[model samples]
Target: MAGTATHHGIPLRSGSGLSYRFDPGALGFELLPTGGPDWMARYEVLHTPEDLRRWVGQSRLDPTPEPEIGAEDVPAARALRDALWRIGLARVAGEGPADADLATLNAAAARPPLVPVIGQDGAAGWAAPATGAQVLSTVARDAIAVLTGPYADRIRICSGDNCALMYVDTSRPGRRRWCAMENCGNRHKVRAHRARQSGE
Candidate 1:
């Protein structure tokens, strides 16, 4: 999140204590911004096989320990991320997601993300090895549901400074802008106060 450089052609941001943006339940699209900028200097979280494993855990897509993630999993995950970003951006712009992106997403959705099983005491839970491909599929399925679901219209890009994170504006007025008040919202308020004092 601090250092700037390139890794395997993708921009890498490295620093201690760098954390992911927002809570997991806030938005499924948060993974796309993991690398950094959507266009330039993006630090791909799925850059390595290990990164892929960590991403699955971080996303909470599956807590099950995954088998070895291969080199191929990285690109597959990145492709899914890109497609989700495009689809989300299109919705924000009042346009429909492209056919190609939809197709890609649908394909992934068709795959079984995880197995279901009855747990102790008759409770149900998902079970799986949490392989790399399955993780990507889970994310794709989430994106598809969000884009096609009722709340899709409420999605918006965060208005915070230098923040490209996307989120659902569940505010009552539906006029929410920043991803979170503690992060970008406070920054905006501070800037506005400075401007007011400067004018006085």
Candidate 2:
């Protein structure tokens, strides 16, 4: 199925529109789709430390004790995002993941992810005290899980026009085309309608 519906409008051009959605498939693939055909104008969602913080917070992987993201974490976060993108693309192509990308991911995975904490009331919760690296590690580990698991075969790139995002096809029919119906599906539909009218 497509992602949750939102009112975010579509931009015909690349690197202008920014839509964020969480798919039930994988977390690592979510880092992509910020930019499109234009590499230069590609809008990076996590452009600042605060953006990283918001992304992680919204992820809900480690909610409490929000890790203080600093300038140093931004580059690492970007690098990790790129690495995951490359790995995801390779998975979709039925090709081996790049050795360098694997190495980078492995290194990130080596770091400890969020650990569960038991409250005094016996209620359990998870937290990553070292937010920066731990959060990034968590994302890397998620990618690793997806890439190595059976779902890796379901990896698909969105077929939306000018949309270059990867997603895991978890539908029953396994024929999901766009990442989200509200995001690109509607745009495709409108464009097709315009074409039909123009042709007639």
Candidate 3:
């Protein structure tokens, strides 16, 4: 999870050893890598309360909160994540998300989210002893915002081969196509270059 020097996003390493930044452009999309529904279960990383807490720490949540995680929170988090996955992918495909998936997101969003407060030092911080439910509620709310907001039409799946990662095209021109220019984008460029050379 080394941070990419040039990108304002999470760093990820491919199986082939290519490391690059991955900005899902929204917090909710971050949960996709923890695992997914059905066939994606093999990538499961949230197996315990600590695992969920670790994810929270690594997430893009600014001024990260140390939530009081409980055993039950793990399954709840997974359910929300799975719902997000389905909904996000549906958006990429220009299809409507399932009613059940929407229900799950709404349910999570209904919970109390993390309470933000100013510290004595005049710094922004979360209220003490936040619960995992609160953290999840915040994530769900973010998903709702991204799915229904102005950039809703900008949702895109990376065009890189074998890459299913989703991201919002926040670029000014909205022409972004890969998960990261240093990774997939570079690979695509190299392949195209080699193809041209061989044809010559």
Best by lDDT: 3
lDDT of 3: 0.83
| Per-residue lDDT over 115-152 for candidate 3, one digit per residue giving the tens place of the 0 to 100 score | 87765676565787789998899889888998889889
Model 1 per-residue lDDT at 177:
83
Model 2, CA-based lDDT: 0.68
lDDT of 2 at 98: 85
**C-alpha lDDT score of every prediction, in listed order:** 0.63, 0.68, 0.83
Better of 1 and 2 by lDDT: 2
lDDT of 1 by residue, 110-145 (tens): 776655455566544456554666656666777777
TM-score of each: 0.77, 0.77, 0.91
Candidate 1: residue pairs that collide? 35-43
Summed over model 1, clashes come to 1
* Candidate whose TM-score is highest: 3
Candidate 2: worst-modelled 10 consecutive residues by lDDT: 1-10
Residue ranges of candidate 3 with Cα displaced over 4 Å: 1-7
